[model samples]
Target: MGEPKIRRLDGRFDDPEIETAFMRDSWAGIRVQAALTLIGFSLAWIVSTATDLMYMQDSPYFLPTLSARLLAGSVGLLGGAWVLMARPGSDSRDLPLIVYGWILMSTLTAVIVASVFPTAEATPDGVADVLVFTSSWMSLHVLAIGVALAAFPWGIAFMSIAYMITYLILAVVWNEQSEHPMIAQSVVVVACCFFAWLMAITFSMRARRRFYITRLYEQAKIAAEKAQEFSSFLLAATGHDIRQPIYALDLNASMLEELVDAEQWDKVKPLVQRQKLVASNVASMLSSVLELSYLDNAKRPVTPTTCDAGRLLRDSVSGLKDVALSRGMALHCEPCSARIQVDSGVAGHILSNLISNAITHSKGSRLLVGARRAGQFIDLVVADNGAGMGDRDLFLESRSALARINGGQPLRSGMGMEIMFRLAERGDLALRITSRPGHGVMACLRCPRV
Candidate 1:
């Protein structure tokens, strides 16, 4: 979170995987540099040989220059071959190897140049010509190598410093060249190398920052997909495992209704009815869970058709009548004949959750469920007249209650509200809730009138 934990000296990421990812991103550039190294140095060696044969055949420095060029060219070929063949992997160390190879080749090239400078005074034009040639070579070498070392800021710095040190040593050894003093030359070369180091740092940092953001985005996408997959799996397993028992209980309840004797029926009928009511409530709760899961995944499809809003309201209320009765509350449905254009199944589920939530959490003795025509839309309403709730209580979800529950507080019973809200949203229906503490609570679902 704070500057991303990079190493102070080498700029390597503290996390090895992160470092490896950066290296992988740099691999293509490294390979290209290797290829250029092989081709560029081969041409340089041939040119130098030809130039010596044409102009400097009798010069004392000709053999030494030819030998140095040959040795440096051979080293460059070998190092370039190794770099070209190397592939980045899980190891964060692979990138450093490429950088070190470049450094070694650059150092060898510097040694070849440095060896010629000490004896520049012996040339026909004295040290001036040698000074001009060395300056041009150093400038061109630094600029070319810097471009080839793209995406590796630290490597560029190291190579530049190595070359500078080689030049400085040569300058010290050739102090006899008084006309164009070696000390002044060393200072200019050092400044150029240092400036290149700074530029390389800026370029590499920007590249690493981009790679970091991309990696984070990919990781987040994968995590989200896996979470959705896990949610779907859990929903499927829960529906199967829980529905089997509920289904068996339903079958047993039907069998009991048929097989019981008339004498025992009077007493047993109530128990069977209670069992059915409990089973129905469980099934309804399960349906709510499934609906919520579907909505979370954005996979629930809504098909709007002409539906009797009145019948839906009555059916939802009727299913939860026992729950209301058990809680010593009276459930009522107002008369209505409104029709609406909405997905019947989705609307039914929303109505059921609304009615069930009121039955369980309204804490009121009187509950009302009804629907009425309101211009272009039919509005289904569930209102409770018991001890009302606050706006916060109306919207508080079950998950948010976990912290309170852990602190020895009662968990809020608003999971149903959350589910109903999502279901209504998916069906393109409007849901609204109004609650006032100690007054009452009312919820409305608005649908297109048919």
Candidate 2:
């Protein structure tokens, strides 16, 4: 046969590759968050440096000005650490609390540092210089606002409370003596309050968007699972209904052969033989269809028992000898004499599907089925020398062949494989498939040795 023209289903690729990509993307998001926090801190630091230079020589509040800058920078470092450690197994919930605590501490420290500095005279030229100088201290406030906006919107509520307490203390201590202190304190209070409100709004909008995305993802997942369940039900019903008639036909065909004689067999012998052949083919097709459907649904119950692994393998292969011969393929079973505790029906089903799959896909004359005791388990393998599947195809259908049940659908065409997978899962067996194009395929199913 020419090389099998392999094609994969749309948007369906290897699971491990997709998982790796998801982890990379998640790490990238965390890095972006850390970078944004750093940029906000940098801007605040630059403003503090300019303010410190303006009031350097004669300013009584020079020391306090330096203290505010140090506090803000420290808070920025803490925030960066929080983002860095926000990995899957790490404490994600505690991060927001840590950031909130840092912001609260920075705000209280800034308020104390600002109060220690004496108010300068409101000269025309000095007013502009003082405003520029004070703006550097405002960086701490900006950083606090940014933290509230970026992490969780509700976190601003805690920061706002901390800012209010700090503002009240400064209002009572610094503005009590000056006649115009109320005017100066009011300006600062209004500016901080407005910025906090704005940050709150921004946080709410972002939170809403995140909530919507999460809901949509959950809905999609539930829908996919439901669809899979429905497919399994359809396959089970089809198998049960279709197999009953086929079994009856096989029995009747066998009975008819026994009643006929050789003397008058010339006329009736050919018709009976033809009827039996037709019945057998019909039964084979129906059985395949049912097996495929059952496998696809994979809902069968498993009953594990202790049995001879070698004996089970022999019986399964004996049943497939005629099938292999008819397809011009050889079937051989070599079993290790060991007892295994497993779901016997599931083990049998798995072997059946592997053997049938090998015959269907192979152009080779021989197939091999065997098992060996490995540690506490028996490793069973079915190998075929036929037109083997490519890596991409093997990867796609190895876990669940339900995707290949329809020819037009570019998925496994039978329920038998799905049933086999479900059985393996229930039996706690390790099932693996390996295939190389033009070489052949090998399927391994491992179960605990009794």
Candidate 2, 216-254: lDDT as tens digits: 687678857855874774466345333423443554455
lDDT of each: 0.65, 0.56
| Pairs in steric clash, model 1 | 364-386
TM-score of each: 0.52, 0.52
* Model 1 ranges off by over 4 Å: 1-3, 24-29, 49-61, 81-102, 117-126, 150-158, 169-185, 226-246, 259-450
Clashes of each: 1, 17
| Model 2 / residue 54 / CA error / Å | 6.0
